[model samples]
Structures are given as structure tokens and as C-alpha cells.
Target chain A: MSLDPSFVGRTYPPTAPYQVGREKIREFATAIGATDPAYHDPEAARALGHPDVIAPPTFPVVVTMAASRQIIEDPALGVDYSRVVHGDQRFAYTRPVAAGDELVCVNTIEEVTTRGGHGFLTTRTDVSTAAGEQVVAVWSKIVVRGEA
Target chain B: MELPTQTFRVTRADLVRYAGASGDFNPIHWSDRTATKVGLPGVIAHGMFTMALVGRAVTAWAGAPDAVVDFGVRFTRPVVVPDTDEGTEIEVSAVVKEVTEDGLTRLDVTATCLGEKVLSQARATVRMAR
Candidate 1:
């Protein structure tokens, strides 16, 4: 199914705040074999100038994944979820996400196009604190394969 | 300059743990039935998992935690993990692409499974240690 190019530049409302937790950060770090003390120990993180344990760079995916559902599940978008695959992912940060930060995401449809038999959608999610302090920007590109 | 190479073992249990931690219960990462039904060659590792491991390599090379300012990757291929005790392994290596005047170091990274590139256009920029 082809995506509507018109949807490009559309912005969605801010998602509910996702509170970053120390244990969640630890779990994510452990899963990837990242034993950095800043990801697990608060004192260690504080020594590095963080308020608390810091999350791994990719940890924002936990929030943006749910936030993106607004776009992917839009009936008008006509995305066939079964045929979808992650094509690209990117993250740029203003500061590391620390445990106890209430992070919110505002998602935007950066681009929508079709090539051959597939649909490509690019989304940019701006993550910020509830107080509106920007923390990071995450970009995701997904490919919707044509029916076989 | 080339960074030291690192290898990580990915077992079926690791995938399950990652899925739970990352909240990606797509089933394709754990269920062979769901994976094969979806045209996959048995259960596969999550592309994000592979990226996270690469992130570890990048931070290690930078010699600082929380130093990454930019990171990106293209998922070019899947890492198929067989149902065995020793599932599979991914090897991550990188080269310093540039060091900016503003104290940032950029790295071009490569992650491979079974000698086939699984991630392409992989790169990261990190704050140089003070």
C-alpha cells in the first residue's frame, strides 16, 4: 500500500510523559552487556555530572515506539503492520536521559514516499521533559512491503 | 584510527530478555512459528538489540559513558539465531572518521553476524573526553 505524501509534515500531539526509571535503565544496559557504572550507580553518575543514573542512548525507543502508534495505526495511513520492518533509526541528544525524568514525545511525519512496490515513512520524534526542555530527537524510517 | 573489535554472543535467552526489557513483544524475535510465518529464517534478533550492542562498542571507544551526541544505523539484514545453546555472535568494529575542533569525535561503525554485514551506514558522534 502506498502512503499519502500529503501526510508529510503532519505533527501529532505530545504523548503522555514516560518516567525514566533507574531499574529500567539497568535492565536495558544489562540486556546489551553495557556495564558502565553511570548506567547503574547513582553516585557514579553524579560524579560524571548527572543528577542520577543515566539511560543508554537508545532507551528512548521505549517511549517513541508507543508514541509512533498514532501514525502507524491511523486508519487513513493504510499501513499494513504485518509487512512493516524497521529500515533506519537515529538519535541526537542534548543531554543524557536521567532516571526520574518525565519524558514526553512529540511525533512528526517527516516524509512519506513510495518506490517500486513498497511504502516508506520517516518519522521524527522530539523527546523532552514535561517542562518542555528538549532532551533528544529520534528519527525512524519504516518500510511497508508490498503484498506478495 | 581503528578501534579494538568486540564480539557479543547472542543466545535465544538473550533475545527473550531483550524483548522483555525493550517492550518489543513482536514474537518474531522469539517464536519460530511466528517468525517463519512472517517469512523469516527462524527466530531473529531485534535490529535494535544489534544497535544497542553497537552503542556499547561506541561508548567504550569514546572512553566515556553518556558521551554520545549522535548515533544512527540502517538495518540492512537480519541476524538469524538458531535454536541452540550457542545461538550466534555479532562482531562490532569501528574506525575514527574525524575529530572536530569543538571536541567531538565521529566514528564509522560496522556490525556483522556470520561475516555478513547486518547494519549499514552506521555512525556515531561522541563528545571528546575532557
Candidate 2:
């Protein structure tokens, strides 16, 4: 089923604050083989002007992906999660996310369209500090394959 | 100018670790049965995992962990992972697209697996080291 075009521009409520942990950053960096010292050592990060060990550039996806469940699971929107495949991803950062930052995400449906019998949905997530400081904006596009 | 190329190996173990770290437990990335059921050839690497690998390349090129200001990619193909210890390899290379007056450098990146492009329209902007 095609997504509702009217759902575009619909914004969801902000998610609960997610406290960024140093070890989590380390674990994520390690998982990606991002061995840069700044990702694991507070002193190394401080040398680069960050308050704590900074997350890798794509780290925000961890939070945004979880936050996006609000839209994907919306029965009204009718997203077939089983048929969904990631199509595109983009991130614009206001500042690097560092450990100890309490983050919140505000999700919005950016676009919804149908093409070639497939449903395409785009979602934008604004990530910010719990104190309301803007951190990063994340965008994701997913394609729902038409029934064969 | 072209930057040095970066390469990464992707094994099922890496996918499992990435799934744990990123909180994306999508069975398609680990379970071959689930993947084939989904019409996928076999167990595949997560799109975010491939993006993260490219992100590593971007930061490494910028010479600063916090240098990336913008990054994006289109997932054009799947990096299918065979159940093998050697796994598959992804080769990442980039060219300097522009260097702004304000010290931001833009890069056009390419990532390929098995000699097939897996990402397109891949790019990154970073704060250049002073």
C-alpha cells in the first residue's frame, strides 16, 4: 500500500532524553573499527575541543533510528515494516555529539510518495541536547516493496 | 586532489557487533534464513553499518574526529556477506570536491564491494585542520 501523502509534514512528539555514555561511544566506535583515540579517550577528545569522547559522524543514527519507530509503526500511516528497505540517509551536524550529552529527538515525516508500485517515505529527525541545544538533523528514506 | 583510499572487511561477526552497538537487531543482517525469506540473496550488512564505515573514512581523511559537518549516501546495492571468516571487503576512496574559504572541505566519496558500487551520491563536508 502506498503511504498517505497527507502524512507529510506531520511531526511527532519529542522522545525521552537519551543520555550519551562514554562506554557506549567506545563500544560503537570499536564496532565500526573507528580506532581514532578521540572516540575512546576523554583527553584526546578534549584536545580537539570536545567536552568528552565524541561519537563517530554516523553515531546519531543509533538514536534517530530508535526514535523513528513512532512513524514506522503508526498503523494509520500503514508502513509495511516487513517490506521496508533503507533507501537513503543524510546527516547535518551542528556540533559533534560528545559523551555525557543528554539527547532528544523530534521526528517529522518529510515526504511520502509512490512510484513504480512502491511506497517511498522520508523522515527527518532533529536531534538536540536535553537543554534544547541543536545537535544534528538526520534524514532517512525507506522503500516499501509492492506485493509480488 | 584525491585522498588516500580506505578499505574495510565486513564479516558476519562485524554485523552482529554493529547490530548490538547500534540497537538495530534487524534479523536480515544476521540470519540467512530471514534474509532469504525477505528476498535477499543472503545475510547482508546493515546500510547504517556501511555508512558508518564510510564515516570512518571521512573522519580519517579530515584528520579530525569531529570534523565532519555533513554526510550523506544513497544505498544503491546491498553488501551481501557470505558466511565465511574472510567475509567481503569494501573499498572507499574520495576526491576533494571543494575547499571553502571558511575552511570547510567537501569530498565526493565512493564505496564498493565485490567491485560493484554499493553507495552512490555519497559525499561529506568537513572542517579542515588549521
Task: Give me the candidate number with maximum lDDT.
Answer: 2
Candidate 2: how many backbone clashes?
0
Query: Can you write out model 2's per-residue Cα lDDT over A17-130, one digit (the tens) per residue?
Result: 999999999999999999999999999999988999999999999899889999999999999999999999999999999999999999999999999999999999999999
Task: Report residue A30 deviation for candidate 1 (angstroms).
Answer: 1.4
DockQ of candidate 1 (2 decimals): 0.89
Tens digit of lDDT per residue, candidate 1, span A64-89? 99899999999898899989999999
Q: What is the TM-score of each candidate against the true structure?
A: 0.98, 0.99
Give per-model CA RMSD: 0.8, 0.8
TM-score, cand. 2 vs. native: 0.99
Question: Where is model 1 more than 4 Å wrong at Cα?
Answer: none
The 10-residue segment with the lowest total lDDT in model 1 chain B: B56-65
Reference contacts recovered by each candidate, as fractions? 0.83, 0.98
Binned by DockQ into CAPRI classes (incorrect, acceptable, medium, high), candidate 2 is high
Model 2, B1-130: lDDT tens per residue? 9999899999999999999999999899999999999889999999999999999999888888898999999999999999999999999999999999988999999999999999999999999776
